[model samples]
Target: MQMKKVKIDSDRCKGCQLCINVCPKGCLKLSNTVNAAGFQYAIYENESKCTSCGFCFLVCPDVAIEVSRKAKPRVEE
Candidate 1:
């Protein structure tokens, strides 16, 4: 099975919430603690529910989000 991963650049985020709104899986959310720029940056909260659809990346204006999938290696007997 392949697992999806999301990476958000907190420093670059402006708390626009565009990515959070576009996420189909509801995997992203605004952090309670603000970033250095004093904005509540988006963070990936739900790892199991994410489908790696790249919707968040497409919507983020600041280019702060990255989505990737990692496949587990198969073990041969």
Candidate 2:
């Protein structure tokens, strides 16, 4: 399985939690730590369960979440 990597911009997050609710794999959670804007940010939890489905990214009102899949290794000639 391809590993999914997610990057979140915590400063821009408003703690809306829309992304957290929308994650199918339960990969996101609200952090206890707050960002510079005084809002709790979304974090990727249980990363091994992430499918790179992009539900979190699409639902983010803050556009804080970015998800990418790890590329598969190429077969050498």
Candidate 3:
């Protein structure tokens, strides 16, 4: 089975928290510290359980979230 990963771009984040709310796995959380842009952004705490559903990425208006899955190898006969 392939695993999923979530990446957050703090620079582009606007502290919307939309991705946090949309994530079904509840892996996303808001950071207490602000970034260079002075915005408190969301972060992924529990990345191991990420489903790579892209819900967070889809809901993020700032386009800060990136979801990707590991490519599985094909079986050769």
Candidate 4:
């Protein structure tokens, strides 16, 4: 199984909690600290539990979230 990672671009975030509320896994949460834009954005805490479903990325209107599925290594012949 490949590992998944979620990257948040705080610069583009608009502090919308839509991603946080749409995440069925409940892995996303709003950060207590404000971003440079002076908006409180949502962030992922338990990324290990992420299903790589791209739910957060799809819901983000600001295109702040990035979901990547780590490629598995191939066996040498």
lDDT of 1 by residue, 1-77 (tens): 55349989999999999888988889888899999989999988879898888998998899998889767699999
Which structure is stronger by TM-score: 2 or 4? 2
Q: Which candidate has the top score in lDDT?
A: 1
For model 1 the TM-score comes to 0.83
TM-score against native, each model: 0.83, 0.83, 0.86, 0.83
RMSD of 3: 3.2
Candidate 4's C-alpha runs over 4 A off are: 1-4, 72-77
Residue 60 displacement in candidate 2 (angstroms): 0.7
Between prediction 2 and prediction 3, the one with superior lDDT is 3
| Model 4: per-residue Cα lDDT over 3-77, one tens digit each | 348889887888889999899899988888988889988878787788888999998999999898867799899
Q: Sum up the clashes in candidate 1.
A: 0
lDDT of 2 by residue, 2-29 (tens): 5448889888889998988888888888
Where does model 3 exceed 4 Å of error? Answer: 1-4
Q: Put the candidates in TM-score order, highest first.
A: 3, 2, 1, 4
Candidate 1 segments whose C-alpha is farther than 4 A from its true place = 1-4, 71-77
| RMSD versus native structure for model 2 | 3.7
- The superposed Cα distance between candidate 1 and the true structure at residue 11, in angstroms, equals 0.4
